[model samples]
Target: MDHILVTGGAGFIGSNFVHFLVEHTDAKVTVVDKLTYAASRESIADLPADRVSLVVGDIADQPLMERLVAEHDAVVHYAAESHNDNSLADPSPFVHTNLIGTFSLLEAVRKAGTRLHHISTDEVYGDLELDDPERFTESTPYNPSSPYSSTKAGSDLLVRAWVRSFGVQATISNCSNNYGPWQHIEKFIPRQITNVIDGGRPKLYGAGQNVRDWIHADDHSSAVWTILTTGRIGETYLIGADGERNNLDVVRQILAHFGRPEDDFDHVTDRAGHDLRYAIDSTKLRTELGWSPRFGDFEKGLADTIEWYQAHEAWWRPHKDAVEASYAAKGQ
Candidate 1:
């Protein structure tokens, strides 16, 4: 049986990937997570205990990583400080986790001669001009603007280094924004859905003109799995559903789903250095791995996502207090 190791397996995308792996493949999966505030084990509450092994730990710990890499057939790295606003507030953690942590994992995999699949973000391409018709292809130049994306871009280079210098069989995937079930409430889709459901004002950053290509988390996970299993070594694949929408349009869609008006949002100042637009060209992954996103429709996907959050208050409500406290601590 193939034993696969997943870092940050308790996180939103990581947790979803874990479930997808266990259900779809016979691989003996080991999950190593630091279980930070954003990571809730409850996300995997339904996973069978026997098929999965959860290791509570950090990926930057070289010793633990070396051992895990030696034992597993492949490593799927998903751990990182992902919040852009939080990264702007403090960049050290992003550097530590996204850059240093990725370096540590690459070193471990190199020593053990193991295969690795690194998950990356399209934010590495920075912002696109409104009139720029080009999407972020695999060959796009790295022009990351935010501290968070800069660190991720740094990590992507390291993955390439491992493949070039050390001959580590590695594949990288850069994906667009993800939205679906089990997402943290702090994220836009869930936050807006929950707020609209409870008769609260949705917070908007600036004029909410920022555009993003959103993909369902399930589609993203499937793309990751496909790339890991079939992509060429030392290559990069862009994973996107090609569903682009401006921030305000997404917010309006969520509000409409809840039978609320579009003007229910409280517009606020834009975030510092916020990227105006991000879109990905996933044609490479689709053509090479025969992977196509099944949930590319924003309207239907947003509706399904909103409905999931509405019906799962037991899963989301407990985190409300903690989420509020985090914002309060951040003084947002």
Candidate 2:
């Protein structure tokens, strides 16, 4: 697509995707973001005006969505209320932003006939048994555990229905946990990194045995682009890098990075209904689309991420205090 509308483009993964577009493709992007506490204009402000334009707005606004969708060749939707803790505290925003917002975008695409690609998460497939040896594939059945994941599951279903019932040109992808530069300190990896940066200890939940499949955000961006152009309409792809690590292991690595005792972290109350493990088999994306992660080793990827937070203190410093305070309230 030559001109595209990206919802939530100022947020972490979306901003990373926008940067990836600027570097890898010729498409011009118009970003629609609510600019919530999770979003930062500075994340996208440095992009060339000719290539990227920011529009402060909500994704659920039908008139606005229609206008932007009509003006662009496609919509790469990344907007959602994504935090699990916030969703638990109040599911209202998650319902509005993730469910209703997706419905609005689907309607716009249905009317405008714009090519659409929806971003979703692997959490929709719920957690797997630690010893299951199975991984989530495109055909995995939905079993969302939290309000945030449930809303995302709902949005993915909406996209599928729009494509089948209305013939809207659309595709969907469910990606693994993403970590890299530009990530908000509220997120797991960045939270731990910034905690140590500020002379605080990293915190773990329960026994810290929950496992997550991790993929660098940049790799997630490239995989999305591959699916957007070459993927078939009405199909779904699972994106991952096969980087799986349990919570305790990841925390220990973070501590080692800071030259602190690996056992320095505190155990916080575990999340309500925490998923046990998540693994994604991305064979389809790799074998069909020839996609592979650039950051092959998880430790290497994570070390680079730690270095990023070190070098870009100005970018993350402003949000550090407030994010930690929020976590502190939750005893995380």
Q: What are the Cα lDDT values of the candidates? A: 0.89, 0.94
lDDT of 2 at 20: 96
Ten residues in sequence with the least summed lDDT for candidate 2 = 319-328
Collision count for each candidate, in order: 0, 0
Candidate 1 achieves a global lDDT of 0.89
lDDT of 2 by residue, 229-318 (tens): 999889899999999999999999999988999999999989999999999999999999899999889999999999999999999998
User: What digit string (tens of lDDT, one per residue) describes model 1 on residues 156-224?
Assistant: 999998899989999999999999988889887888788787788777878898999999998998999
What alpha-carbon RMSD in Å does predicted model 1 have with respect to the real structure? Answer: 1.5
Q: Which candidate is the best by lDDT?
A: 2
